[model samples]
Target: MHLTLGLHRAVRHEPSSVATFYEGRTHTFRQLADRVARLAGALRTIGVKTGDRVAILALNSDRYIEYYLAVWWAGAVVNPINTRWATPEILYSLDDSQSEVMFVDSAHKSKIDELREGSTTLEHIIYLDEEEKPNGTLSYEDLIEDGEPIEDSYRHGDDIAGIFYTGGTTGFPKGVMLSHTNIGVPAMTFLCEEYGFGSVSLHTAPLFHVAPLMYVIAQLFNGGRHIVLSGFEPAQVARAIEERKVTDVLLVPSMLHVLLDSPVVQKTNFSGLRRIWYGGSPIAETTQRRALEVFQPSGLVQLYGLTEIPVVALLSAAWHAPEMRKLRSTGRAAQENEIMIADANGREVPRGSIGEIVARGPNVMKGYWNKPVETETAIRNGWLWTGDAGYMDDDGFVFIADRFKDMIVTGGENVYAAEVENAIAKHPAVAACSVIGIPSHEWGESVHAVVVLKPGAREFTVEEIRHHCKDLIGGYKSPRSIEFKPSLPLSAFGKVVKDELRAPFWRDAIRKV
Candidate 1:
């Protein structure tokens, strides 16, 4: 079955049920299905044929959800642009993916003029806003009203559904080709394992990212209601949860920290919240413990994976108890996937040994779009080599250490940045921190940290930080240098951009790892 099948089932099973909530408006399943079908027909009228690429650059909204379903219903592929990307990055993705039709919401309409000038393949621009149509663009609402409903394309199994781009940090973004099965199967598995029918799921995370998109699919599969927010703000999220009685939400660790810290959260009612899923980066133990205290009724679930392979493992709610020592782990392999730690030679490593994380399953992407060599290097013998360093315990729990590229070699010893960052996070004054290796004449490379202190926190000296870290980690692993900033640079999904932190120090280093 394809993704659209869920929509069809929802329409048949519960046509009168509320399907989506945006702002102060609500849409029933029947109305949503009709809009989706008409939007698909409208897309066809605009020359979107099967296998064509249609891109959307918008904040999270009901329109964004419609954009996803309509594109697939029309038998076209989706290329969701990262909302955090600048003009150059946006242009590169549009040109690289060869997207023909573009959708822009009111918030991002300004970029359309600039994007239109640089994009050669973007032929049609559809405005997704309630205001008057922009010059040279068709209104999204008009398309649904004027066009006729179309039949489902029934694109199933290996048919490509979307081309998700990755690697904007290191270099050019490569479109990772994900098929209908690659996404749908895993989403269904997650739905059965974690979600329940008629649940209310909140969409505050960016839809451009794979994790949130997967959550969207899971909600659809379970016939759950969706409450879409334009973007993530801690206060807004808390307000939405209290008002809408949202059952589940998917947030990165950074977003969780902000939400837990927000005073609005303490006053908001979390009685309806069932689960809070977090991932994209390792969360500090201190933050996790505090989260447990604040969100008492809500279970915290940790998901671990990359765009290439959506979710390889999950730390379930059962493993998140405060008393559980395994809370630090990324958890065991997901039921639908297999995870293994492999050395550089592609040989499996023993438990408790650090190595690259490799996964094999139906959830793995087909390959990198238009890059056969890179695809070959990434996947071998049916296993996708995730460039993440981690170790498995004897009981089969996986603990992520760091990304392969983020490993810091200081004085000939390996220092995983996550470990150092976790130690720094334990310091009460620190709100957020990122650890990286910097060039040093004496040590070859020295451990350096960029920290963001909690608001109104007293100033901390480098020596104080070093001493505090010494108590948690090895003295050698303590950061030799510390720089404080008001905030850290985060990606659309809330993962810290370590490469950005490492760039200035390594500009003349001939190579960046």
Candidate 2:
């Protein structure tokens, strides 16, 4: 299936229906379709070809939706750079994907000169904002107005649709190649689940992330009205839901906590909300209980998956009941997915035995761009090894035990330990360092670093280490807490034992993950 098929269906069925809302502006389906077609034509005029990569580095807005649809309409692969990425990380993704054209908004336009110098393939920059266009950058409105509307490119099936960059285990980033089928399957599946036609969905989560991006695609199929927020601010989210009568929203556990804690939640009326789809990280039982009281009519759902495979399993509202005893589980596999717990030898482990979670389905990503070896390792025997440790119960519910991968999910964003370790290792006063996730009530888990100072070297402060890492990584990926240790625990193989570092912090926790 083509990624743009939903947009075509929506426009044909309800041309005059409200399609998107951002700030004080609104657009109908016909208007959105017309703009998308013109933008696609403009892209072609600017030398964008079918299968070429187009990148966008901007916050969530109505324009973000347009860019996503326009790129797919143009039959080009989208390379959405993470908004939280540092300049080097952003440049690396752009260069790795060979993106010829990139769109930037007012918040990120200041780095255009540096990005241009660092990127090997970047040729054009489009300013996506109401503000005056910067010198040497193309104006977003002028391009749409000047170009002719074009027909859909009609790319479909196994054709590559987007290249999403995710944190790498090797202290770099991996460009995850997803085909039309990889994204379309999940979008279609959502129609049979909680989302339906005419649902008013809120886009508070970052659009660049897979979870939020998939939600956008799912809404397009149903002709739902999208209420776009620049970012997730508790006050803004609560006000939008109350004013727009938003029916659905997706948030990570951390975001949910902050929103519930904010004073605005109690004052806002969210009676129109039908579902709260939470994922990206596990939620604390205390937080979930509080949510039930606050959002009485809204059902709580848990979506379990990663960027590589967007749809795997979903814990429905019923399973969240206190008597269900499956509240801690990630729920059964999706209708189209086949999931199992596998041992090290690639053999399926018996039910109730903890093992690595493995899955195979149309939702699985095609591969990592330009990394055949890593692809083979990830998708061995037609199953995508998730690197997440979990077990399935007799009733098919999957319980998350721990993570096998050297990764952390803090505030729903994946942070590879090696990436932070690599950054900290660059400090002049540090002799050795190991990064790990510590139990956090606020972020679910927080990045923590254990360092050993070099002999005869000046003692380094937490502020100094954080300042050094700011230029190398995102603020969220940097350590929130630091511990100075004499040495790190090592295994017989001489590799740092991260579990040992994480043990003390999680000892009294309800869940290990």
Candidate 3:
């Protein structure tokens, strides 16, 4: 189940096809394989060994593609640093993973000196810029110059592949030990599904993020070309889709929303795009329907999965069901895994009953790196308790109520803040919204909504908006108060930072400690 079996298969079938496109350069499988081998050999020369950790701090570039195969070829663990993370978080992950070598792109070169200084496990830093290489860090090109194509250190399966870091309740990043098999589950799902495959996939999501990386790995296995961009900009995405005749894309709700509203998006050609997998947040039905009208059948699918167990469920184009177009449902258990909604005690809940959503599958993370207790708490009885609150319909479709952590308990009733937020978001003027629980004197915890208004809207009061929401949802579910902001804080993948939203209120609060 190692990547080579697939890599060698790809090389034999189509060696000359463009596998990666970045910075106006295309890399064929033959060339990529060669580079990966030589880089792995060079890493070995630098004393990298099996189970050793190598980290990559990069933007979406050709070297980033090489980073994946090279680390796996050397049988070393990969820890991809989040571009959005601050230095302290990045330092924490590097220290925790015990990474020996780190590849920092030109964009992050300035921080390399500081990051490397405090990392006891880090032995070397390689700068990955095509033209300019920093002085202190070794050049990526120099290291690969005519290095021997060393034999692969080991084949893959349950072996450690990547130390993928995701946010935690502890407020520190936890490295999720994702094996080759773990990634392969999502890779195989898209490949075998017969829908997600294409000649080109618009790589708008960051490659370091596991949710997006799942598609990148799948594209490689399927011989599809990846069109990489430095970052997500609506103009770039629209232009790339037209220029490359891009056929599929994985986009967050924010990007999708921005693109749909951009003039370039409407004017630019998108005749070739066959699939658009929108996720990373609860997409409003109004927006989902508008997308379908714009792109037709190609504008299909609303997939739901977290980095922890990314293969939660997939909604096919057929299920887009123009009529129903249910926006917030996360779909059902993926064909490869079981998704269960259980009570706090972990007993399975019946259909249509709301509870905590958990999953068990080959795709689940092995554990949090070096934190057995945290691992045990997350993956009890081989099930990855996702901490999302959702329920199954008789049709087996999973409907997400809200995250268990995001569920606001006000007074005695458990109010799903998402229901209230949905009511608020559906308003014509509301562009984006996040629901949170703020401290309250009477209710103990009162529902609060932080909202962003669309451009061109006139000033509106919070009471006016709260009154509009009460018309749709129950009064109790309506936000006790609304906070206006230009935009909600978002992660690189565009997930709302609920933790950051509540940080001020929670500064001295003891929550489940």
lDDT of 3: 0.77
lDDT of 3 by residue, 222-285 (tens): 7778889988888998899999989889887657767888888668888888888866655556
Give the winner by TM-score: 1 or 3: 1
Q: Judged by lDDT against the true structure, how good is candidate 2?
A: 0.91
C-alpha TM-scores of all predictions: 0.81, 0.98, 0.80
Ranking by lDDT: 2, 1, 3
Tens digit of lDDT per residue, candidate 2, span 467-499?
A: 899899988899998998889999999998887
| CA lDDT of each prediction against the hidden true structure | 0.84, 0.91, 0.77
Candidate 2: RMSD to truth: 1.0
**Candidate 1 Cα lDDT to native:** 0.84
Look at candidate 1 and tell me the lDDT of residue 4: 86
Sequence-dependent TM-score of model 3: 0.80
Q: What is the lDDT of residue 182 in candidate 3?
A: 88
Model 1 ranges off by over 4 Å: 168-170, 406-513
Distance (Å) between predicted and true CA of 200, model 1?
A: 0.2
